[model samples]
Target: MAQPYADTIACIRKSTAEMRDLQRGAMDLDAPGTEARLEQTVRELQARVDEQQAALEQLRSSSHVDIQQVAYASGNPRDKLKQLRAVTAAYTGLTTVAPFLPSKDSMLPALLAARALQQNIRGTKQAIASAEAQITANGALLKQEESNLHDANLIEKALRDRTVRLEAQIEDRSQKAPAQLAKELIAAKRAEKKRHDEETQRLGDALNDFVDNYLSAMLAAEELGGPVVGDMLNVENETLAAGFTKKGKAKATKKLVSGKTRQRRIDQIWGSKIAVEEEEEAPLTEAEAADAEMRELIGILFKTLTGPGGGRAYHQLERDSAASRFLIRAKIAQFHPKDAQKLRLIDFGRELDD
Candidate 1:
């Protein structure tokens, strides 16, 4: 019987424990090197981007033009070249006058340098783009990781709430077993008590009727000599035993009763097989057997509550005139937690007194 309850409690605890582990797992999604590795990757990518941009800027600003290279403008070469030199001489902070055209020696070097700077700018821009692309890709991954963490948090909370509910339900049911059983026991005991009280009253009434009839019959026999109903059951009148007082003659202070009458009444009742007025029901049937089994169960419940120290405590509850009946019905006339962490019985006897 209790095995089912035990199994349910165990299962609930196991589930809660697993949920607790899952909660930890949710929080630990980014354990050890996960966050650190992501941070390092982002930082390195960004640094490479900064370095490439700086290099590109330096290449763009490097000296790519000289008088020789400016001589190669798109126009009539000699006129355009002299015009460029005059403008360069005015604009440039140089001590000497500018050359109208460049010798072959300087022209080749300047042309090569200009081409090299252009190539460096293109390559550096590509490097910057590549570094930025890596960062962007990793950034999106990090955003996904954050989204996953948010989902994990919600999932963990939902699981925790479920675990809490299961815990409450399991404990409630576990405690309800004993609590419900205790209620049944109380009801059974009350019924037994009421039945016994009724039976006692019935027997008492029957005895009174029997005594009245016997006395009346005895009186009628003494008067008219008609019945033998009281012939064997004569109760002698109580008699005084004489004794001397301190001053003089003997006198009776108390009356003495005879045992003969009592003995006769017992014999008459026993010999006649007189029974209570209630019709006796035959036993040893299915209903009686079931009743006997229920009685056994009730006895076990009794022992579980009041038989030993530290059993279920029956609290004498406080009463409310307005809500006493409601409180009793709600099992709060005297109440305790409906869980095994605390177990007690609530008795309404005090409230009944109130």
Candidate 2:
């Protein structure tokens, strides 16, 4: 067999042996190791017996040949005389040529030499026939063995292909099956959501920073004689807006430019401060401080963006201008994702403007 196929078969056999061992272990927990050793000893004895049997067969085949005699012992006297005459003629012919032939012993008896040469020729013919039979048998056996090897190679290839398929299935089940894909998808989604949340948080922080700076700039501008908007809705103005029509005497007696009006407005403005002076002031929570800061920033931005006449500066920008695009992007980033998606669809295939 080829080396690779031999290795494959070895691997398969090893795997089969391991599986058999596991099965045997499961089937007989109390099986002794001595029993296995005994089985191995029996197998070895069987192999030795097979080898001896093959050797014995070869010996029997070799011993079956008969050694031919130089002369027949149970023939008629006339036939025996005839055979003697033939031997005499052969011996005479050999002696005549003996002077020209190479010989180890020149004085050896000619009759005995003729008889020995006759036996040797008969034995050689028998050996040649036996050798020819053995050659034919060997050729058949070689062809059979070649066929067996081809079959074994085919079986090995099939087993190797099956092993590859089984391994691929196992790999897919472990790493690419539906459950594995689902797990991967879930992990990817979680990662995407985490990234999205982080980006949103960063954008919010940036917006907050920008709002703080804008607020500080607006405050400085106001200090430099800008339009007064910080006190747009003071307590007195709120009171006047309420119209003072309630049946309560405090509301009914409220009049503009009166001492009571001034006192009520001052009281409303400083009520929390006065209460704090009377008792220990509690510190504001983080949420409360954030809300106050947000409210102040919103108030300033709202007043600045909307003029005293309540018309927004946003309404004055051209529809496709840079300022409009910035405003649109800011609104989309802030709170209009769904609307932005729709707008993006509408704007698809349209030429972009400045």
Candidate 3:
């Protein structure tokens, strides 16, 4: 029921629209404000570099202080060492100076100060270098984006012209008389319904097969004394675990309050059914939790199948090898919030040897 090129056409349309926006400089990347933002970033980085440079100059001035003269000026040994330590610590960024300390016998406060100043100067230069590199990278990216915007405009225009001509030709060739058109419409509707029915049946069969496999796996795990056997076996039956009865054909009946008539809502908009009232129940056990998760996943799959454009997507997945085995498994894992990482293709009973 789906056209083979539906996704491709949709992609082209989206790309063209984005290209049009880009050419108009309406997108964030190409907007007039983007340039202003870049300029602001450059100004901020430059200001930081200037601030660090000033700090560096102050540190250099402090490093040039005559520590040796200060230490010699102190007569007491203890006083000399204390002065040396004080002088070294007073230098900016030199408080973290380790492996170099003023001892009672020999104190080299000047060398400690010089090492700290060297580290600070190196760090300041590195920061400046990083900022400059980022600015250069940003300029290059902006140029590339601008060039791409021009190219995208050309491509978008060409594609629009081609698609318009092709669509016109298709429309001209597809015209039919009223009577014949009505007849063809009936046949097409029937065919599409048949396809839908077949896919639904297939999904139901897959669900049943999946339940069997799950039961089988649980049994096997039980035999092997696996860790989760108790949790898996806690549910009364596979039907209960799946939250539906086989005879009901996946329709779940809920008890309703007396004299009340109401429709029950399922997970999504398309899952409305007859319902009654709720009854108080105990909290879910580990087994019930797992069963609830499986029911939710099944509901999602059915919802996607019945949703708008879902038939086309499912048709693609059925026909395309790239979509069938790998993609279906991926979708299952993605939709399943719990045990996603633990899920395998075989668990769904869909993918075979190939």
Candidate 4:
């Protein structure tokens, strides 16, 4: 029977051969999983080689050394020969069982097999390295795409937020449109009406006051000098009262008076007297009248406070008293509220009787 060590070596040899065949098959197939399988097979074969080498070392340490002793101790020469032959046969069997058993260089077939295995492993490793590099590059590309998507999403969100805010502002402005326009129109109309009313009132007041003062002054003058005062004073009444003469009687009397006698009598009445010459009244031009009318219109429009008279009465009063120095100051103070405050004339000189 073959020694147990020989059987074990034979098993190792067979396993190694099988590993080599698997590596070759993997290379031929060149499938996706081939590289991984070939690498696994190479590792297993390397392990087996290590195990077989250890086994060989153990066998050489005891069994092989004792084989010679066993051969020598045999008594019969035939038995000794047979023992030697058995040892020799055992050695031969070990050699055949694993050609590369004693050392790595022992078998030509094993060396060739190992070399083929190494080449296959190297090729498999290179394929794995290439695959891993491609995978790494693909991962980088995926990360870049993800980053770009993130940036695009952020920009879209910001634009959406801005659009929302703009829409809200537009909606708010639209809602307020009618009310705002109405308010502005109402304010403008009110201002225009106020100005017109005030101007009308001022003109009415001025006209009324002017007429009243003029009539009063005329009456006072008449009261101061009676009808015959011109004869008593012996003054040239023609120059002093030309326009004031009565229509029928006064015109005839002035024509009957002799020219030289009239001159002498006028000189005797008042020699070198300062004569009050009536200023020639110039009629209002078109431009002046237009300006006056416009002023009246403005005053009528803007009279906020009611004056002494209603609108018409105030307009007349303003015209009549317009030239009176005292009344002008009073009217200015009355019309301008600021002037009234500065002058402290809130009550218009009205005092309560105690």
Clashing pairs in 3: 255-277, 256-276, 256-277
Report the C-alpha lDDT of model 3 over 215-290, residue by residue, as the tens digit. 3334322222233333455333332323323332322335422211111112121122212226734333223333
Off-target runs (Cα >4 Å) in candidate 3 are 1-136, 139-166, 173-175, 215-354
Residue 118 of candidate 3: its Cα lDDT? Answer: 55
Error of 1 at 257 (Å): 99
Q: How does candidate 1 score on lDDT? A: 0.48
Instruction: Give the per-residue lDDT of model 4 (tens digit) for 1-354.
Output: 224544655565566667778766745665555555555556667887898889888887876456556736588899778878888898988776744333332233444676877886667556656655766677789889899999999999999999999999779767787889689779989999999989978977886565343322332122223233223232223432321345212232354545455444433332323132368354332222223333443344335224443322222232222222233343432333333221111233443111
How do all models score by TM-score?
A: 0.21, 0.21, 0.26, 0.22
* Candidate with the larger lDDT of 1 and 2: 1
Q: For model 2, which pairs clash?
A: none
How far residue 213's Cα lies from its native spot in candidate 4, in Å, is 76
Best by lDDT: 4
lDDT of 4 at 199: 96
lDDT for each of the candidates?
Answer: 0.48, 0.47, 0.48, 0.49
**Candidate 1 residues 204-240, lDDT tens each?**
5774465344343333222222223334354222211
- Of 1 and 3, the candidate ahead on TM-score is 3
Q: Give the TM-score of candidate 3.
A: 0.26
| Tens-digit lDDT string for candidate 2 (1-354) | 244544654565566566557645543654575456446655665776798799878866887533244346436788668768878997989787734332332222433554575576566556656655766677789889999999999999999999999999778767677887888789999999999999978976786675444333332222223322233222232233223323311133244455454444434432223222236565332222323434443344445434563322222211122212323444421212333221221122332321
